[model samples]
Target chain A: MKKFTCIVCPISCSLAVQAEGGGDITVTGSKCDRGKAYAKDEYLAPKRVITTTVKIDGADIALLPVIGTAPVPKELLRTCLRHLYGIKVTAPVRMGDVIERDILGSGVDIVAARSAVIKKG
Target chain B: MREITADIAVVGGGPAGMSAALRACGLGAKTVLIERDAALGGILNQCVHDGFGLLRFKKQMSGSQYAQQFADAVYESSASVMTETTVLKLIPGECGSKAQSRQGLYTTGEKTGGALIRAGAVILAMGCRERPRQQAGIVGSRPAGVLTAGAVQKYINVEGYLPGRKAVILGSGDIGLIMARRMTLEGIDVAGVYEIMPSPGGLRRNVAQCLDDYDIPLRLSSTVTEVHGKKRVEGVTVADVDAARHPIPGTEVFVPCDLLVLSVGLIPENELSRDAGIEMDPVTGGPVLDNFMMASVPGFFAAGNVSAVFDLVDYVSDTGEAAAEGACRFLGGEALPEYVTVRAGDDVSFVLPGKIRRDLPSSALYMRVKRTIENAVLEILADGKPVYEKKHPIVTPPEMVTARFHESAGSGVPDAGGLTVRILGD
Candidate 1:
């Protein structure tokens, strides 16, 4: 039995997961199906989406905020951030522009969180 | 000074200001949004983290992305926006057909010169600011590395600079938890988070994802007693606190760190409101507002963090929309009705819209708890008679509870008696 807090929503349901010999997983205290799915995934192998920034050139700001398009393996968050920190993109980066594809082979693309146009001369 | 005329003048271009300006424009009123920052997104520009706009968009979005949704709409709308503009003063209840004598705002813009913005209604949307170390009451030498979590966020996410390689965060609030994760991801060693209260100040989700997931330590019932640095922060002395939150004598521990981040609390920026002599709420530290988000002064409104510091940006935007709607109503020459006072009762910190008009068909009241409790019932009472009740499995001080009341519900809400929101717990 494992206790987990569901972060799927603001409700923050505390889910109790029970499994015996991996036969079947029973999740309790989740208000919605999304929380159930989150509990199962968290129980099997925890994962999280990385949200951070990367260096950008020719933009008004020095850094361009980015987010992983999907959640990746939780353990690889540090490695993914290391990859993002080294990478730099130019201005004209649009929202959803892929900064890095298949980051750390996690199959999640790092996309720009916001658009940054060229700096005014 | 130059003069600009509009139906509505919105100060601050954050989520609330943008939403208010957009909503006001949608109602066919000429709206002008004035922002102190260079960009229209305001604080959201530096808040690069995800998990925003969950309620409104039904999906987790980065703060910047969430702000962009409204920013894009504002740009497409007819509402005029003035970035890098500072509103010096608000002269409420003074505007009319005449340009010079109109109730208006005195503002100065970096690109555009100082101007008198005459408007039929003014919506104050300036958001809250973080409490610094001095305000947090840490006896320390003035050091360069001590900064608020928001400032560090801007430094890392916007300026691409790391203030320090090692840090100690004070306060277990959401921002502190998020910054702990952020700094850890940026290769900074966070010694641990020291919180004065026994319980975490932020949401449980943040504790689960930001700290627990990252293997960071959350030390409760502890606080930074003293700072030990001169030019730059060298270290801090932390101590465990007793029930009264005073530091225990023998429980002091020295932790070496380059930066000390303060996430103690947020106070609504109400200088303009105070200067205008608006009735203020001693608890919320904002304005005494009515159901329409209208301030004590007629034709003057307060919204978003300027009214109360909200946990979610969604609620902030909601207040902004309400203020805009109220401003539009004021412009339409709606007559003011008798108001019923709304009071905070037992176990509640504060409630927005300090008062509500007696004849209002419906109104939403946002509130927070004084402490955490499970199996509690949130009850709304009118003149000591129960009007509405909701059973909650749990309630925390950090989480806000929103209760909406409709006069047509036949809930026996009186027009003369005041409304009191309280929590019934064992």
Candidate 2:
């Protein structure tokens, strides 16, 4: 049996999972149905990414977020950072504003996490 | 400015607000519920979970079902509910105002603009929100698949879209824990929940119910130090942390995953409250209230999650009732003495009901701890006396500690003294 913890909502469930014969797995201990679903996937595959701010021009603030809308592959973080280093946004950014959709065709969108105004001089 | 008057005005149409309005109307107050949303239910609309009404209803209920019942109860009441209306400000009522009585509200905004409904009382029931990823210092290759736990839940439950198949999550908060199970149910790959604390930030039942039940590994005192990917996420570098919380060298390992969900923590929604000059308690991110749940400004009352994040809906409702009554009592000319003052003590993260009047009955003090302890004693001291103390077999930061007092200790005059809570005998 494998163990996993669901930290989604306040109902953190300590899950117990057992792989059956094939890709099928038995899950228990989830506070809700979502926990079970989380268990099956962890054993099969896992992925995630980092979301942060990038420098912007002609805005009140010098930085805006490029939050990940999807998880990128695990090995190419440095490569992605190099690309972001060369990127910059113009002023008047809104929270949740999409910066790049299907970024690099990774099926993810980089969005602003918070709103910032272009400072009036 | 416009003038309007109601017996009771409840801000926020969430569960607490709706329940408060329903209760107030049932108590013979003509209630008016003002919701900023197009609908009455606030965050509950996005919360599609099932463990919502367990304590309030003594039965299992989905978030939507519980919201419907509360909405129905409010509908049945004589209280008037105005949706998509924002309460911009509160002021002295016209004509009725003099030194003896203060005008309660001069409201402005799209929904209830230019209307002054003299609410005999008011209840503030604003809710909380999630902290974003950038604050967590999760460095990674710029790509996608990172989102707050709440957003993921809303996207799947409300918008009916799948975020991704593979996933990794940072922070083992309740939302993250539950979503782990949620995404997994949709046949998506759920990676793991990582926590920087030695213990889980969520309730123990959640650790047991959500993660333990599903076989998801919880890396305690660990973190997602780096994200790996180019156009998309390919993996994450998770490392164990020592007591100081710095990642232990040589312990770094890479895990491949697609989606990352964060459930770091919640902060009270206080932008409006702050702008209104309400005195706030930094510890709880809420406001300082006397026994009546009234803020520094008269007629400006706060309750429920807006005041502080509550573990159960029952407490939210309980606080909401007090806010309404406090507002009404003030308007009705009931004399409530001012508390000398309130203060937070050592071992105590913070306490609610920051003050109490001499005439007011002793109130409930809600707080949490700074860390975990075994065989701990939570002691409440008033006027330097051991007013109340309780020993628990165990105490953790995630679970809130609640202690109430109804009897006055000495002069019954709060201004004459003060109170403090300390943890001992661990």
Candidate 3:
């Protein structure tokens, strides 16, 4: 059994996670339904973001915060990085700008996280 | 496609939705509150923090307590609160959008779609959604552990789960800072928080109370460049970004961690609004409204996060009450002055209630900065006349700034017909 705290609300509950007889984890100490679902997801198939800076080839700036639209599988993050090597974009990068779509064919896009100037210097 | 109606239909059930519903019902309007979730509380239910309710309740309380206050008020007001009711579309009715259709497989007996009651006014308090890593342009490898700060909050606070044992946060928004402290209490090592800007995206109190007090390291003018690891987030590389947002060649280092938490920003949920054909401002991501907070549709009004993202729940409640009353007043056939529109000028990032009715009962201006400035004076301009200006000590890009232009601040203005707010630096 592992003790954990729920991160969904401020009432971060001290929870006990134990593997039941059927190889399933049971979560205790959730304050609400949302927490309950989150606990289950955390125990099974944990999801998260894919963020990285994309190199802008021609812009005065070197990089921009690029991220995937959704969480890729927990295992595929490395293969995803191989795709961005030597990749670059021109200047005047806008927030929400897409640098590469379906990056590495991983069903995720590398998008600009913020707007940036191409360059004047 | 069925028609359903109420005396007053409130969209959303967060602080604003509840406040509006309670006020409308208190004022004797048959109210219907619609929420997209199975529960009534909007983001508050997930916010386990205790800083809320300072202004309205006159006491600092937890988000749940604050939400419960409205919940109890709602119950006593005898308002009909519908959970998991996503409003599919808004069509004109006998009052306005007299004919409307909502789709839900369940709630047929309890909800009874296609029923008619005929609301005279409508209040929209749909709240907002967080901007994802894509929207924020966070750089890194695709990994399993990075989640939005709010999502992290939901996972840890609500469900009793730990997202990670060691974590790195991108963006110092309130949630990120709050989570920084939260992770510490859980004995999780918070690797660091990185922001491209020199300042934070949250309030001064949050910085001092949540981060400084906890001994969490917050790096400014820095950003993460890549996510490392094959399956889970093993670590990230932090680098300094120049004034032009370029990575400095020599300023890169790798910080190993299992989780990355994002506290970027929020976008108002406007899908239903768009389906209803309400006009939206591209910048604010919400419906343009008259001073009454009423949208372009005559009887349809918006408030709270649905109108624009706000820093405080107090403001949400304030706007929510206004929307409720506005709905009642409209339904009662109250006459309003023709509203003139308000615009955010060059220095301004965006303003809420993008439109103003000529016949406004009361007006409140909410705004954020296009970027950070210091030692500035706020100038409220009306038809090119300086109406209200105040000296400010410091301003940051992320923190929202608010100044009221009620009757008290009147500068002998003749153009009460139309007005706008502007900021100038000393």
Model 2, range B1-426, lDDT digits (tens) per residue?
Answer: 665567777878997788778777777777788887765667766554556676567754555556666776787789898876777765534337442233454455575666665665667787888887777887545678788899988777555567888888889887888788767655677878889989887887676656765678888999988888887777888999999999999999998887778889988888777876788988789988887888887777888888988776667777877777777677677667757555667677877887876566657777777877767887766677776778776567887777776546543343356877777754
Of the candidates numbered 1 and 2, which has the greater TM-score value? 1
TM-score of each: 0.96, 0.73, 0.72
Q: Number of backbone collisions per candidate, in order?
A: 4, 93, 49
TM-score of predicted chain B, candidate 2: 0.89
**DockQ values of all predictions:** 0.72, 0.05, 0.01
lDDT of 1 by residue, B304-348 (tens): 988998999999999999999998888888787888888899999
Name the runs in model 3 displaced over 4 angstroms. A1-121, B1-4, B92-118, B138-141, B359-361, B371-375, B407-417
Tell me the tens digit of each residue's lDDT in model 1 across A61-107. Answer: 78888999988987898788887879989998888899999997899
Model 2 has a DockQ score of 0.05
Best candidate, DockQ: 1
Query: How does residue B325 of candidate 2 score in lDDT?
Result: 72
Residue B361 lDDT (model 2): 66
Ranking under TM-score, best-scoring first?
A: 1, 2, 3
Give the C-alpha miss distance for residue A58 in model 1, angstroms: 0.9
Report model 1's interface C-alpha RMSD after superposition on the true interface residues.
1.5
Candidate 2 i-RMS (Å)?
13.3
lDDT of 3 at B180: 88
